[model samples]
Target chain A: MVLVALLTGGLFLPQWAMFIVTIAFAKALVALGLMILLRAGLISFGQALYYCLGAYAAGALGRFLGIADIFVQMLAGAAAAGIAAFILGFLLAKYRGIFFGLLSLALSMILYGLLVKNETLGSTDGFNILPSTLFGTRPGPAWVRYAVLASAAVVSLGLALVVHRYLRTPLGRLAPAIKDNEIRVEYMGASARYAVHVIYVVAAVLAGVGGALAATTVGHIDPDMAFWTTSGEFIFITILAGTGSVVAPFAGALIYEIIHTTAYDLSPNTWQLSLGAALLIIIVFLPQGLWSLVSKMSTRYARHP
Target chain B: MRKVLVALAVAAAMPAAHAQSVKIGVVTFLSGPAAAPFGVPAKNSAEFVVEQLNNGQAPAPYSKKGFGGAPLEIVLLDEAGSTTTQVTEFRNLVQRQNVDLIIGYVSSGNCLAIAPVAEELKKLTNFFDCGTPRIFEDASYEYVFRTSPTATMDSVGAALYVKDAKPGVKSIAGLNQNYAWGQDSWGDFEATMKVLVPSLDVKTSQMPKLFAGQYNAEISALLSAKPDVIHSSFWDGDLEAFILQAGPRGLMKQSLTILTTGETAMHKLGKQIPDGTVLGARGPFGPYAPNNQYNKWFHGGFVAKYKDEPNYASYQMAQAFLGVKAAWEKAQDANGGKRPSNEQVAAALKGSTFEGPGGTVKMSIGKGHQAVMETAYGVTKLQGGKLTVTNVKRYPAEKVNPPEGVKSADWIKGGFKAQ
Candidate 1:
């Protein structure tokens, strides 16, 4: 209900705010994918591989194939990323800890190296995509922006809600159990690697969808989309939001954008100072993340009242 | 009675001083690797230009008060994020901030992202320093304009300078940071060299990753090739780091090097820039910019404020801001001294010509929507313990730039011509 209300209300807000919210949610979707790993006590540092693939797939379809249909382009991106992840996840799921993280990072860097080398893909300049359409009719900038916003909101909320339900299932509940004791999970007659592989593919799809939506919103894609720093940012948001609740990543992403941008805007000279200070405070006071503070506040209010 | 009538007439002749201030949004890298050499100087120049214009403190033609007698309001935003973030910030500046004119974007990718959006929004945008020809080559837009030479001009200018000055330079090598700017620059130089210096053979090329800040292997490769010339388009800290590393290895002694944006970093790089290295400030910028009272005032004021020499990016920023001011003034003139609408300003700018710190900018190129400007570059030598570009040669805008509506690559292949 709250998500629906906010989506509807976002229409009347300023265009820039809508833009921020739309992009924030797109990034949150990616962070939510990272949260899956966070819950499983695994962190894949190269999620940008899927993210960049999705963006490039959507961008190429729109730019070269003239497929301006938003759903078709975005789904194409997710499908492409899903297939790639499915093949790679088998090998990826076999590893754990820093080795797994480094392998993912290597995969992303390989993509980056290829994109940077391909002059036809704009080399470093990147290519721009045409405006997306609703159904069959091409829309103006205002309409396109709103369409992107609506899609961002609906998809993000839908994913969060669906993932929320998934958490109650035994397979979902086994994630943390696998993290806590993989040997125990194996003794129970289920392969933890299979469970991890499934989650990996799901996370890949989510990141693909996120990157596609981001490409749609930005109307541009480049090799930097796969850069390690971009993947690092997703990991940072994952830690900041924690895996406590499905709603947490969205909230964390929104706060992260606000803080990161505020620091940049307020003090360009010492912008790092402000962001570093905020992250330090959050890590020190609420190790689990802002979600823990919110839960604690809610429980305290319930007790007092 | 005569005195009172004269005062009233004078007041009526000028537009009301109370006209609404035109809001200008300036976006550049406020915090990032690109900031130090390109973004910081450009933003600082924007600040100085806006300040001088707002206060009627600027020198001639630009002396017009605050873009047609309206006090200028300026907003500076950081273009320090993904291409998506820059696009969003552009929308924010235009839609939410309500800026009439946006002058920004040093990154070629960032500029390309915002170009079509500006046309979609119907907001006037001026690109000061982005060197990608694709902005106009890939598509045409009525609202977007780049007021400086593109990569074609910069690369071709260096090649021409070498051909004219060092005719015997047969084998040329390249060491560019791997990115859009580097690839385009190197590609254009090779294409131009194919025509201008037919005997020129590229011995080796190296593309170190951007901001890699390490170039031992690449420098060694170039040195081993023993090319007569080395061409590069690296700028900012990357260029500084490359030169600092490559200089000690005797790369300069073996090869005649051209730094496309070398002059911009001369203030800091100073004496370390070995004598006789060719330098291209992207245009006739730095100490060797245009010679005029306006140039003197700008250079002097920049140094007085920032305590450093104005660079190519700085000149480009001042030129872009001045172009906007000139367009508004022309539009206002056509309006019989009234504030011109955005369309009127765009129309006036389309076919207009304006004097800048770097000679003249002809906005009549690419069908009056894009600009073509003459660029000057030369070999560097130390003068009184400061890095200076000498033997400077200026390439006419028509000589280096593809004619309006010509694809640069196609133009080069067809023969470098103005026709």
Candidate 2:
């Protein structure tokens, strides 16, 4: 039903709203990567490392290599980011909490440094990619936007379902167990570190795919994609969404973009203040995040009905 | 009832005559790292020119009775956040706000992102002050045109000034923002300087991160390399920060610093610019612009309103506004006492030349729908407790600017037209 609405009802939205929702969906995909790890009680502050990789990879494919097919670029982006994560996961899974966060951050910063210094990839300014295409045919920007929107809706929903199923599996059930008591999980003959490594790789691929979609939608990418602040934003959305379900990050991402764009429109100079205050209110009132509120309201409605 | 219906239909038909102002969406950074120099000054200039046009106060040519008799209704949009956000905002400006035209962006990336979208939306656009040659070089658009020269022009002008003024200079060093804009400017400057003076040896080059705004290490490296000259294309807070740090360190005492697009921060730097430093205004911009009536009106009008001498961004804004107004007037003339469609305005802008505040800003039809204009060069000298650009010289556009589709590096390497 949500995918149907995204395809059908999304068409009726004003151009700005459609574009806004597209951006929201892109960010949500990245936030979902965080949401996966948050369920395991792990945080990656350098998610931008994968995000930038996805973006640059997709950008290079379209801009330099002349592959405008959206699916091919997205797959290429995901593969490149996944490979990087697979290599880095060994060192990362051994650590937890702040060590993990800081290490991820350091890794992302290294990418940022390399990108900023290299002029061929456009350095800080970055470069533009080819206009988005459906299969092999070039479409107008609006149609391309619609195509991205539909893809985002379907892919996010599929990822959510897959993640939901993963949670019920033996490996999936070990996530929360590892978070609660890693030593106990290890005592049960499971390597808690190996489980984390799997989760880490999963999140990395998700972030890469998200970055690819975002670059195609925006039609540009820069070192800013790999900047630590961008990673922080993903984390912000993860917190706002809560770890309740695979779908919360989608809602959180939408609300964040709406509030952010509106705040900036309302007060261009003091928008950051508005964003901070909103986050503060969310923390104080709904600590588990906007998703928890939804569950509460649904429960109340069901009982009354 | 029949007569009333006829009157209503006439009123609706001739909306332009009944004072429906030409709505323009102006996009500039109201708050960002670039706000100080590139954004605020540009916004102020646009506001000032629009007010003058609406009121029928600016001098001749620009004094064309409110955008060909349709007063401008201005909407200012803040350009901040990622390029995607800007692309969304641009669509909002066109689809949601129903702005007839858009003028925007200080970042080259923003301009490049918006250009294709603007063309897709079929909205007439004026990219006010972003300096990337890649915009036109990469693609051609019927609806998009930059009224000012790109970074290549500014870098070339700086190189020309250095060759003419600092005849004794042998070794050169570059300190530019590490981005496409910075690198492109360096490539053009380094290549052009080598052509102008073959013996000019490169001692050291630094590509600092954009908006890093701290240059202690970059400054130390420059001091150690000890080139006879240092060329930079830094702008906004970064340039101000560099001057603040490098000025006190006596780096200026060792080598003459050449600031490409330097005039934007003249007021902030003033005496701190150092006496022997060379600078270019990106074009015939700022106080160093040609002494013409259009410039006199602009300089005097801006100072009277803002209580500050107009910076390079201000002059460029004025020039863009003037170009837009001139196009509108030509469209109006073509239509014969009526409002022309956005397409007509774009058509009029093509291959048209209009007198800018500094000099003539003209479009070459064969040149990938891009505009080119002459550039102004100056040397900073401390006098009367402030830095003033002296020994100012203006170079012809055809001489300094590379032709359409020719990479600036290739052009400089090819000896700038002939042996």
Candidate 3:
């Protein structure tokens, strides 16, 4: 029902509204990946590495190779990120806690350093990519944004459903158990490192997809995508969204975008303060995040009525 | 009863007829590293110009109330985020705020990202600052216009100044920020120097990251090279910090340092900048601004209101507003004294020459979407505790900027042939 509403919202909503929703959904994909890590008691502070890789892959394709198909660009983004994640997962899965986070951050910054120095890709200023086309045809100027929005809605919902099913599987249920006691999970005849590696790659692939979509929607990419602060924003959204359900990240991302946009519009200079205050309020009042509110209300009404 | 009803109708109709206001979205860095040096001054200039324009207090040619008799309404937005955030904000400015026109961008990255969106939206947009030449050279736009000269002029003008001031200069080194603007500026200056002075040798070039405050290692490297000249395109806090750090080390005293965007730091860090340092304000701005009635009006009002001389950023902002006003009034006049559409205003602005606070700005490049103006560079001299520029050399717009259909780099590579 929510998916239908969002897809329909593309038709009637103003350009700005559609843009905000599209970006929110794209970032939500990254947060959704972060949700899996948070549930497993892992924090990867450098998810932006995959995000940047994905965006650059898509961007480079459009810029260098002249491939404008949205699906092809996204596939390239996902494939590139997935490969990088698969290789890096070996080293990353051996660690947990802050070590894992810091290592990820270092890796992302390494990419940032390399990108900032590469002059052909326009260096720090980056470069613009051609707008995406649907298969072989370009959408009308008025409908182009709607096309991107529709793509985001369909892809996000499809991935969310898949992740929801994954959460129901035995392997998926092992995340909380692994978080509680890794040794115990190893004693149960499953390799904790193996599960971690799989999950890490999955998370990276999701972030990659999100980055590509964002780049396509924004029509520009830069090394800032891999900066530590960008990764911090994903973590912020993940915590705010909670690991309650597959859909919670989307809800949280949408709410965060709305709050950020409204606050920025209201006070350009002090918007950061307002955003900090909102985060503080959320952390203080809703420890389990905004998702907990929905779950709490649902349970309370069921029990009392 | 009939007379009273007619009077009431006329009163209501009068308000309806005169209530029109042109909403313009003004974006700048309200909170960030760029806010203080470039963004705030531009914002201040916008506010000052709008207030004056609204009251018809501006000098001749811009004395019309507001834009073509329509009061100006500005919706300000911050330009502190990544390109994606800037693009989203640009859309919001047009679609959500319903701004009739848009102006402001201090970062070349933000400007490049916003240009296509402005074209896509068909909104009359003006870029007050942001010095990259790619915006016009890479693509063409009807609705997007840049009111300030590109960074090429600054580099070329600096090169000309160096050639004229230090004829026998030998080796050169660079300490530029590692970005497109810095890289492009250094490249142009080096290319121009090669064309003008064939014997100049390159010693070493250092590129620290943007906003990288500490330059100890880079400064040491530059000092060791002991080149005859050093060129840097540092701006904002980085520029101030470089002067502070390099002055005590005698780097500036040893080498004839050329800061392409150095005029901004002159007022605040005058004592720190060593004499003989060559500086440019990207164009004829700040100390190099011409002595014209419009400039006097703008400079006087800016100093009176802010209690400080307006920098190049402020001048550029005023130039953008004046350009808009000129175009709007021209379109209105052409439209038989009625409110003009954005297309009409854009048409009037294309290939038009107008007076800026700095001097005459010609929309002669980027197919008339980009501006070209005369640029000046000078040697800084601290005389009696007051920092003043001396031996200023002015380079005409045609002499410095690439002609309409040529890219800046390519044009420089081809020996800067006259069009």
Candidate 4:
């Protein structure tokens, strides 16, 4: 991936490569947020709500205070989104599976309706984002591209290591056990609600980070960031990557970006058909996704030895 | 029980006192991703206009002459995103508040749905910003009037611009939002292009569902089509997203990029737009070119009051108000300075020319009481990093109107000649 990035450097390749890479990174961050919830056996369809929450927070603060610092805006957004998740998460952690998903979706839609109804947030015309400055200086195009790439890489690598370390802990094992048999975990003296709430809040923060990054990349925000369709997209990312590793979301996001770019270029009208067909093929042939296919193939080769 | 009933009957029999302020209903999408560029501006314009209207300045173009000799009041309503919601809200506005007229409905779907309800309730409506030709094509109700041109009119202007500006252009491709406006725009442009430029080949046509946000795939396909020109009718965030993605990709650099609704995004894109890209307003450009007297009047007054240049949305809203004002003046003149009845006001609105900020618009009463208006085209460029439009051209409304009493053919059949 690093080598490919180097090859597609702004000096050599089309500028779109870097932009696509930046978007892929941001999407991976959002997908990673979903992975955290999936780890706790909680399905969330309101990730978009957190995404919008983070984006709007950043945009509003950036515009209102004349603070164009990317890091400061991101921090403000993450903090706001975290607070929102903590409050909304309390009610959300009680539900599980499809119920959890549906409830989250309903809550997000309610917020969507509010933003749409309120003229303060620009209603549907969307809020224009101030051009982000890193620290006190405005970065050039090359620097912005590099900064975005580095952010993606750091988030992906950092989150994967964190998730990997987390799974080694007894508490982390309890998450899946609670998913499998909550009664057994309860007998083991675990509070399922607290564990799930922690997971939800953590996932929201990660999604918030992703949303902030995406806002910087796209340079705008609107209520659609909190829509059910966007939440469904996160779920789609999860399903495409499977729940094996933290890296799965990043991988899936990359593949999805590639597919999106290529399919749109192939037949703009029929591109959706191409995307749907590809997803269908993946579901039918490799239910475990491309990553697991690699894992399965490696195991098969090792068995021959 | 009899005494209570008698008291209730007496209370109901007393006529409800009218508020000192004139109430105008403002409807548009207020929530969701699509609201940012479209709904927010619409609501802001309504607030700004109402504030100015009541401020006692009685601004030159929108002077206090229309409100039945009273101050005007705007009652805002959120259309959300459904026809059912619009219908219910329209009913509530007419039956409950007893508003004399309504002034806003941004989406064509919402306008089409609520227009009949306005007709049924005998309410006067100034349909602003809704551009679906279907709204005008399917009915002949007497109450509905649109201040803005339909998609058919606007798209035809775009086609004319392309022909005049890029005469050598052929193999055209399009990317539009998947809805009534988008569909009609591409359909109109293609048919008109075919009729005018015989050699023009339609290499690609794509409709991305509105608010898709991600445009990589479609962009790639459009780039590959390798057309000499590309036209898009994406509005609000859809346009923003497409431009953001395509700007860096050099798609705009490759083709004669024609944004049918580009004037709306001028403030946002500012100077980021590729030079020489053809852009235009769906109706009239807010900043009229030299020689348009009404444009000069509207622009000067709006800027003086608002302290900002009027956007296309604001212009469209002001046009609606202007239409109402014209109808009111005509009714007053005909009625010997007496306030005309609802029927008379409706008649004045239909088949009358109202001077708009862009230019004068003649409202043609269509099959569904759709008020079709004139169109304007322009060229876009980034001047000091803000989107700037130039070379505005005015097209008469009748040239783009579908043959009267006939539903629009799914495909337009014609040959093109260089206009």
Candidate 5:
């Protein structure tokens, strides 16, 4: 059934429909990273900084550095984000809870300020992503588009399997332990900082992947990717998914895209109100997120089985 | 934070000698996602205008005689469009600086938020470029007038051009920013297109969240829609991204792209934009056909100053200062030449027809006191190794604007009354 749905999604969607799906998928990738950080009791409100780092690296590489190979660009983006995460993660990993959130936010804002002030990277105006090439051929847009969707699907599925596998591992289980009782983990002679740093680097790499995917899809990057509110949006998407699974963030992202597109289309002026109302309703009723409902239904069926 | 506070404090420390310098408060978005495109140009234009004003050559009609011997000084206040920041800046401008006149604010939300305060304080407001039709839906403010065309005028005019020029256009794919101006532009354009061409089909419309600069998914969907025509009102970074991605992929080649706010980018990305593409401005560009005498004069002076042709935005700013000058002059003429009071100047601005660079504009008070003005249309082309628009046409404001009794916010709240 799931294969049928995935196949249907792959084959049936019109071009624009697939595009929306890919965007949702990219957003979900970033949101999943936020979910991992949150699982470790670290609420990151600066994911956009890493996202921007990845996107800028991809955009700059693709446009200026003449590296149009999608994989290389994506890898460069991930490596760039991972490097920054490694440095900032060392400082940020020591902090927990709200302090972690604020520090991350501050770090992202600082990047935003730098990007805005520097005219060479197009400053506040932002730079465009050069056309991405597939293999050695300049593929047509539809081909490139389908490739994006396929990439999103593969990445998402891989992440889902990886995250589920992670939960079964000692490190993954220990992450939640740190969330619940950090002192107890410290008493167990495990360095929580190291675990946090690893998770931070992992999440940053994921965010870099998301940014690279975004650059490929949008063919542009801007300082807005590093803005504080953008980071908040990543956190919001993560919270909306209830940390249920890697796929949940993707589901939440799809829902967000649909709602956002519909609201803006109906009335661009009043759509903000619609988004606020939706967020309010979602917060009030389904506090655990839409994925929580899906998980509950599946659990009930599994128990009966 | 300290630097920002210090700047605010410095603005606060300006002397209250109202009779000396002609203090004008200008508000615009200086932070957040939208600033790169809209705010920067607005500030630059204002600075350029002030430099012109201070340089003793006030263009043609804007002689030094307009300022009554007091040099024009601008106190720039950043509204940034968020209500929280807008309110704070509004208080600071009014209470601390005690500006003589207020201008600026490009976002509809900021304009709607601050317009009421201007009305309450009876401060003369010269709106440059807030395009939410809701502003003019209410009763016209005596103290408020906009120099830029309303969003409806811009969109409806483009619709007319599209219907005539690209008669074979069927399916339309739309991408607009998620905001009031974006909504009104989409609504008016769709409505106008439907009215003119009954068989016109809207294939897919996407209003992605505002400032959601990442749009490959939406782009894919939009391209998939296979529309004959695509229209977008995405400004600044969003617009740049859309163009860069869509242009090389033959999206521009396949679709009849109608860019409502492409003027800001035409010079920068001229070659990338496909020929035969339809572009329009919120107000008339200097090169727009149906050239009136005012356009010639405005064009000549603008070229003389900037060494480049005046885009619609620059022309709009010029017209705004012209409107303010006209109102003050009319008031002074009525008040026996001693400089008009704020109320008098406001009354002069309301319901009064004034000749501007874009042609003649009249204020009709609607919901939010929006301004309805002429629209310009053109075809994109590369000229002299630079992006130069050609085949430019100008439609009178009356043809595209809502009929006088339509009660649209742009028509209702915006009116001019020459005292």
Candidate 6:
């Protein structure tokens, strides 16, 4: 029902609202990936690496190969990010805590540095990707936002459902076990490192799809996509969403977008202060994040009525 | 029945009354590293300009009421975020806020991203301060207009100044930020210098990331190169920070430095910038602004409000608003003194000439969608505890800017023909 509502939102929402929702959904994919890592007691501060790679992949595909199809661009983005993650996971899987976080941050910054120096891709002022095409055809200008929004809804919903089902499996349930005690998981004959590597790849693929969608929706990509602050924002959303359910990331992302847009509009000079205050309030009052509030409300209603 | 009829009549009359004002969405960096030097001044100028235009207090030729009799309504937004965030905010301004026109954007990246989106929305958008030439050279848009000369003018004029002022200069080195604006500026300056002085020795070029305030390594490299001239296009906090860091180390004294966007830092870091350092305002702006009635009005108004002198950023912002007003009034005139459509306003803005605080701005390039203006460069000198430019040289728009249909790099490489 929630997915249906989001899918149909394009039919009635204003263009600005639709744009906000589209970007929120795209970013929610990244935050969703972060949630998986958070569940496994690992935090990758360089999620923006895959995010930026995906965006650049989509942008390069249109710029170089002339493939304007959104699906093809998204697939290329996912594949590129997945492959990179699979390779880096070997070294990253061995680390834990701040070491893992700092290493991830270093990796993303490396990409940022390279992209900033690579003048061919427009240096820091990265190039714009052409307006996306649905399959082989182009949507008219008026309908383009709607098309992108619909695409984001469908892709995010499908991925969210798959992730939800995956989380129910024994392998997926091993995340908390690894987080609690890697030694115990190893004693049970399960390779914790292998699970970490697989989860990292999955998370990277999700972030890649998000980045591609964002590039197509925003119609531009830049090295800042891989900047530490971009990754920081993803982590912020993950913390705000919590590890309660698959749907929390989307809600958290949507609310974050709304707060950001409204705060900026209301107080352009002190919007960052507003965002900081919001985060502080959330951390203090809802330690388990916004999803806890939703679950609490349902339980209260059941007990009372 | 009588009360219902009266209510319906009042409702019908509300829109006509509300149409008396024109809403303009103004985007600038009100926060972030750019705010203190560039964005806040532009925002203040917009506020002041809107107030003056509404009251018809501006100089002659711009004495008409706001937008040809409709009061100017400003919806200000902050331009502090990534390109994607900017794109989203732009849509909000146009579609949600329902602004009639949009003005502002200081970052070349934001301008480049927003140009296509503006065209896609078919909204009249004027770029006030971004200096990228690629906006027009890369793509064309009927609805998009930039009322400032590209970075080409700043770099080319700096090169001309170097040749004229420092005639015996042998070698040149550069320390530009690693970005499109810095890269393009250095490229133009180098190409122009090469064309003017064929035997000029080119030394090492250092490119640090934008806002990489620490410049010890870059400064050491530049000092080792020992070039006769060192060119930089640093602006805002980075520009001031460079002066502060490089001055104590005697780097400025070691080489003749040319700062393309130096006017913005002169007042703020007057004591830090050494004498004989060459400065350009991106165009005939700030200290180099022409002493005309338009300038007198703008400068006087800005100083009175801000309690300080207007800089290049302030000048550019006021210039953009003036250009929009001129085009708007012209369109209204053509429409029999009635509110004109965005298409009509865009038509009037195309290839139009307007008097600004910086003197004359001609929308003469990018098929009349881009602006061209003369640029000036000068050496800094301390006077009465304030920094002022001496040995000022003004380069005509034709001399500095590339001819129509020619890219800036290509024009410089082709020996700057048709000047």
Q: Model 5: per-residue lDDT, tens digit, B35-96?
A: 55566556656666666666655545565643654567877665542242353345446645
Query: What would you estimate as the lDDT of candidate 4?
Result: 0.71
List TM-score per model, in order.
0.94, 0.94, 0.97, 0.55, 0.56, 0.96
**Poorest 10 consecutive residues of model 5 chain B by lDDT?**
B410-419
Superposed by TM-score, candidate 2 places the C-alpha of residue B163 at a distance from the truth, in angstroms, of: 1.0
Point out the worst 10-residue segment of candidate 2 chain A by lDDT: A262-271
**Which residue pairs in candidate 2 collide?**
none
Tens-digit lDDT track of model 5 for A95-180: 98889988999999889877765545644435556567766567674466566677667766777677778767878778999999
Off by over 4 Å in 2: A140-142, A302-305, B1-19, B211-214, B365-368
Encode model 3's per-residue lDDT on A85-186: one tens digit a residue.
Answer: 999999999999999999999999999999988888887788887977988899988989999999889889999998899888888888888899999999
Candidate 3 TM-score to native:
0.97
Error of 1 at A10 (Å): 2.2
Worst 10 residues of 1 chain B by lDDT: B12-21
Give lDDT: candidate 2, residue B250. 95
- Fnat per predicted structure, each in turn: 0.66, 0.58, 0.68, 0.00, 0.00, 0.68
State which candidate has the highest DockQ: 3
- Mark the regions of model 6 whose C-alpha exceeds 4 Å error after superposition: A1-3, A300-305, B1-17
Q: In model 5, which regions exceed 4 Å deviation?
A: A1-305, B1-18, B30-33, B54-56, B59-61, B289-310, B365-370, B409-419
Task: Please identify which of the two predictions, 5 or 6, would achieve the higher lDDT against the true structure.
Answer: 6
Clash counts for all predictions: 0, 0, 0, 31, 47, 0
Clashing pairs in 3: none
Candidate 1 docking class:
medium
Model 5: lDDT to the true structure: 0.71
Model 3, residue A177: distance off in Å is 1.7
lDDT of 4 at B8: 89
